[model samples]
Target: MNRRLILDVDTGTDDAIAIMMAGLSPDLDLIACTTVWGNHDVDTTTENTLRVLDHIDHSDVPVYRGLGKPYAPIPFLFPDYADSDRTIVHPHDFPIASRTSDVRATPAVEWLVETLRAATERVTLVPVAPLTNIAAAITLDPRIVDAVDEVVLMGGAHALGNVTPAAEANIWHDPVAADVVFQAGFERLVLVPLDATHEAIVSLDQTRALRATGTPAAVAAAAIIEQRITGYNEILPTGAADTAPVHDALCIAYLLDPAVLDVAPYRVQIDTVSPLSFGKTIVDVDNRARSAANCHVALGADATLFNDLMFRTLSEGR
Candidate 1:
C-alpha cells in the first residue's frame, strides 16, 4: 500500500535532493510536482524542477506551476545576502538543446482543486514552498481540506527562523497563505519545521561519502550539494565546518520512514499579529490545557540513520 503524494515545491538544491529521495522510495508514490517561489523565482524553480526530473530520469512526473507571489500586498525590500550574491545555477548547469516546455500557466489553486477531485485515494500534499498555492486551493473550495489525507509541509520554525528573525522562507513568503491553511483545520497534518531541519546537516564528508556511490542521481546530487555547502561556507561563518541542511530531504525521509524521527504531538498555531513573530509556528510541545492535538511535529531525528537512508535511496535510484 504505497502512499500517494503530490509534492508542491520551489526546487532549491535541497528540494532536488528531496525529490530524488521521494522518487527512489517504494512506499511513497510521487504522483505530481507543483513549482512555487522561494529559493529562486517561480520561473527558474520550474525550470530547475524539470531539469532535475530529466536528470533523475523521472520526467514523466507532471509538474504544475504554482503561485508567483503572496495573495495580498507585501512590503518588498532587496536584502544584500551572501546566498543572494552567489551565481544562479540551474540544476543542470548546461542547457538542454531541447526546447523548454511551458508550465501550467493556470494558477496552482485550480490544479489543486482539479487534482483532489480526481484522486480516488487520499492524496498527501507535501508542500515544501510558500503556502500560496495550497492556501488559494483551500480558499477556492473549503471542502478541499477534507479531500487531503495530510499536509506534510516543510516550513516554519518553533525555534529560530531561517529567513528573517522569526520566519522561514516559505512561511515568511506568505504568512497570509500559511494562516489560511492552518485555519482550514485539516485532520492529519505534520509540519517539518526548521527546529529539526536546522539540526540536520549533510557535511562535506557525507557528500564525499555519497559521491562514492557512483549513481547518476548520486553524482548529480553530490555536485549540487557541493555548490550548496560551498555557498554555506562562503556565506556563514561556521565553526563546525560546511554542510547543506538537506532541509526538504528531511521531510521526505520522515514521510518514507517515520521511525527515523522522534515526533511529538501538539496543538499548532501560527502567529501573524506580531511583526517579529508574524510567521512563527507556535507548537505547544507540551500538552498544555489538554487541547486537541493538531499536529505531530518532528522534535528530534537520528541524523546518521537519515543520511544512511538518503544514501541508500540515491544508490538504489541508480
Candidate 2:
C-alpha cells in the first residue's frame, strides 16, 4: 500500500527532484503539494511547483500557497537591498536556483490542517521547506498534532549549516515555527538533516551517467542536477568537485527505502535565541542523561544506491 503523503515544499532544485521521486515511487501516494517561501519568494515557489507538476504529469495534485513571511515578524531584509541586512545573504543568490512569477489561490497552512482532518488515514507531512505551514496547521487545530502519523522534514544541521555558520535555510527562515513543531510532542517525527543530505551528493559524473537513461524524466532530472551542481560550484568555493546534494529528495527516498538512511534516536532542539545559532539543531550526540529524546535524525546515507534508484525509477517512467 502506498503511504499517503502531503508534500510541503519550496521548489528548490532539490525540491524538484523530491517531487519527481514522489510522483514515480510506488511506495508513495502523493495527495497534494503545498508551496512555501524558502528557497525563493512565495510567488516563485508556487509557480515553480506548478511547472514541476506539469513535468511529472502530477498537475492533478492540488498545489497550495503558504505564508508569505515568517510566523513571527521578521525584519524586511533582502539579499540585494543595500544596507538591508547585507550580512544575511539569501539562498537565492545561488546560480542553480530558479524563480517563477505566478501565485496561487489557497494558502498551504489551511490546506494542511483541513486536509489532515478530512483524511481517513493518518497523514504524513513531508516538509522540504520552512516550518511556517506546519506550525500554522498545528496552531489552527491542536487536534492535528494527534492526527498526523509523522512529519518527515529536510532541514537543520547536526553540525554546521549551509546558509549560515549555524542555521540552515529552512529553519532559519522561521525559527519559531520550527521550535513549535519540535516541542509539540508529535508521536513520530523524523528528520533528514544536512548530515544525511550531504552524503547524498550527485557528482557531475554521476549526473552524466544518468543522462544515459534518455527518458523524459531522466533527462529532466539530469538537467536539473546539472544546473544544481553548476550553481553550487559558482556559489561556494570548495576543494571538492562541483556537486549539489539533493537535499529535499532524500526525505521522500527515506520513506520509500528506509535503508537509504542511517538514523539514530536523537534529542533534537531548535535554538531560537542565539543570534548566531538561531534555528540550529542541537542534537545530544554525547547521549547525556538530561537531554529529552523527541526525534530521530539521520546521520548517514548510501548515495550510490540512491542515485541508482533515481536513475532506474525515472528511466522506467514509474
Candidate 3:
C-alpha cells in the first residue's frame, strides 16, 4: 500500500529536488504540493513547483499557494539577505520561471483543513519550509493534530544555525508559526534539522552523476544547484567545498526509509521575542530547560543511503 503524503515547500533549490523525489516515489502517493514563502516569494515558489512537476511530467499534482507572510507582522526579509522595505532581494536570481503555471482556486490553508478533515487515512505531512501555512491550518482547525499521522519537517538546528548565530532559515523565517505547530504537540513530529541535513552532502561528482541521468527533472536540478550554489559557499561545512547539502531532500528520504536518520526526543521552544533571536529554535536535549520531549530531533543520518535514494528518485520517468 502506498502512503499518502503532502509536500509543503518554499520551492528553493533543494525544495525543487525534494519535489521531484516526492513526486516520483513509488512508495508514496503524493496528494498535493502546497507552496509557502521562505526561499522566495510564494508566487515564485509556486511557479517553480509547477515547473518542476511539469518538467517531470507530473503536472497533474495540484499546486496551491500558501501564506505570503508570517503570522505576526514584521519586516519581511528575503532568505540570505535582509530587506527592511521587503523589495526583491535578487531580481534575476532563482525561483526564476521555467514555464508558466496556474495555482488552485482555493487557498493552501483552506485546502489543508478540508483535506485533513476529509481524508479516511491519516496523512503524512512533509513541510520543508517555514510553518506558516501549517500553522494557519492548525489555527483554523485544531483537529488536524490528530488527523495527521506524522510531520517530518526540515527545519531547526541542534548545535549550529544557518541564518544567524542561533537560528535555521526555515524556523527563523517564521518562529511564531513554528512555535504554534511545535506547541500543538503532534504525537509523531520528526524534525530533520541542519545538523542531519549537513551530513547528507551531495558533491560535484554526485551532481554530475545526477545530471547525467538525462531526465528533465535531473537536468533542471543540476542547473538550479549550479545557479544558486555560490551563495552557500561560505556556509559549506569543512571538506565540503565542492558539495552542497541536500537539506529538504534528506527529510523526504527519511520518510521513504527510516534507516537514513538517527533521531532523539527533545523538548523544543521557539523564540518569538528578542529581536536578535526572533526565530531561534531552542532545543532542550539534556532536560535542563523542559520536562518532557515534545519533538523528535534528528541528530544524524546515513549519507550513503540517502544519496542513493536521491539519485534513484531523480533518475525516474526518463
Residue 201 lDDT in model 1? 73
Query: How many Å off is the CA of 161 in candidate 3?
Result: 1.2
Model 3, span 107-128: residue lDDT tens: 9999999999988899999999
Highest lDDT: give the candidate number: 3
Instruction: Please write out the lDDT profile of model 2 over residues 43-138, one tens digit for every residue.
Output: 777777877777767677778888878887643332422123212222333222333323446677877777777777887889999999888888
Model 2 clash pairs are 65-108
Q: Estimate each model's TM-score.
A: 0.90, 0.89, 0.91
Q: State the lDDT at 238 in candidate 3.
A: 35
Itemize residue pairs with steric clashes in candidate 3: none
What do the candidate models score in CA lDDT, each in turn?
0.77, 0.78, 0.81
Q: Give the candidate order by descending TM-score.
A: 3, 1, 2
Tens digits of per-residue lDDT for model 1, 140-259: 888877778888888888877756667777787788888888888897888888878766777889888888988877887787777777766765433468765777888888887887
CA RMSD, predictions in order: 2.9, 3.8, 3.0
